[model samples]
Target: MEFVMPVFAGIVVIFGLVKRVPVFDIFLKGAKEGMLLLYNIAPTIMGLVFAVDLLRSSGAINVICNFVEPAADFLGFPKEIVPMVLLRPVSGSGSTALLTSLYQDCGPDSFAGQVASVLAGSSETTFYAVAMYFGSIKVKKIRHTLVAALIADFTAAVMSIITVRFFT
Candidate 1:
């Protein structure tokens, strides 16, 4: 395993050299482009981080959780997962932290833990992804992206509950 990366790199360099490609120069060029790309998306990333922080610190999460509690119950999702469900699309780390806490508090075999695990695996940080990719490319009109992504997230959450219930 330790040698895998080096071997892969060596193979790539050798292949590039054999193909008469300037590997080092091309690597430098790609690196420069990557750095500039990161610079372009840095603000989007920071904004997401800031938003997640605000969501937690503003007590808005608590309010939102309480507001969504009845729906969560009716949907057969654990009330403990309210935060995870809300935050999953906004921030992966935030949702993952909630999932981890759920696992610790509820035990991995508990319904809350099972639901959290399934939710974590089944969905993505939609807003962050959209902001990064669309912002980086400077896409102005996101016609169906947001709607489609939200629908997918909804499906994942519903399926997470049903699938976990069935399996357990």
Candidate 2:
């Protein structure tokens, strides 16, 4: 594994030399472009982090989970997994923290833990991804992309619960 990168780099250098390509200069250019991309996307990432922190700190997630618990139960979703479902589309880290908490509270062998694990694997950080990608490209109007992504997230949550219940 350690030698793989060096070997790949050697192959690339040899290929560049044979092709008379300025590999170093090209690498520098790519690095500069990556930096510029990071610069452009940094604000979006920061805002997302701040928003997620604020929600967690303010107990907004708890409130939402409480309000949604009835519907979740009606739909056969575990009460303990509500927070993970709510956060999964918004922040990957937040959802992961919720999943870890669920694991601790309910045990990995518990139904809620199994559901959280499946949900985490099944969903995407929809808002974060859309914000970063569209923000980097300077696309202000997201059209129906946000709606579609959120719908997919909801579907993943529902299916995660259903699949886990079926298996268990």
Candidate 3:
């Protein structure tokens, strides 16, 4: 079914291209607009990255992970997933950085590393989504959404770790 779907999509795309539907020009225009949007948002992304790095270098992240380690273990989670939990709220890039470091420190096949990978994969970029959404619409009701999204991501993380550990 999936193979047939792709073949159908390819046929449609080829048909569109052959019919002189301005696909290339439309694509280039879309790409240009995307690049412009990216350029405008680059500073915000850089600032987010800097803040995350500052958190890491100033020992805040470590302190957080240290305090959460016992509770994490109590919940049957690996201790190394603590940073992933903390960074998930503030910055996705930060969580990814921590995830990478955990992978390197623990090695990918270890239980801790696999669990970290699952946690990282399961989480979302909460702050980035809120910022982009509010920024685009110029609306500012970001009160409960953060809490809700974090809860969802936490659920995803727990399920992902359990599933990956057991089913894989």
TM-scores for all candidates: the values are 0.89, 0.86, 0.75
| Model 3 agreement with the true structure over 133-163: per-residue lDDT tens digits | 6655456677798789878888987886788
Instruction: Please list all clashing residue pairs in model 1, or write none if there are none.
Output: none
Please give the distance, in angstroms, between residue 66's alpha carbon in candidate 3 and its true position after superposition.
2.2
Candidate 3: stretches off by over 4 Å: 1-15
How many clashing pairs does model 1 include? 0
Between the candidate structures 1 and 3, which one is better when assessed by lDDT?
A: 1
- Stretch of 10 with least lDDT, candidate 1: 71-80
Give lDDT tens digits, candidate 1, residues 1-168: 999999999999999999998899999999999999999999989988998899899999999999999988887778888888899999888888888888889998898888888889889999999999999988979999999999999999999888988899
Q: Which structure among the candidates has the greatest TM-score?
A: 1
**lDDT, model 3:** 0.79
What overall lDDT goes with each candidate model?
A: 0.91, 0.90, 0.79
Off by over 4 Å in 2: 1-20
Model 3, residue 159: displacement in angstroms? 1.5
Clashes of 3: 0
Q: Tens digits of per-residue lDDT for model 2 on 50-164? A: 9999999999999999999999889888899888888888888888888888888899989889988888888889999999999999999989999899899888888887898
Between candidates 2 and 3, name the one with more favorable TM-score.
2
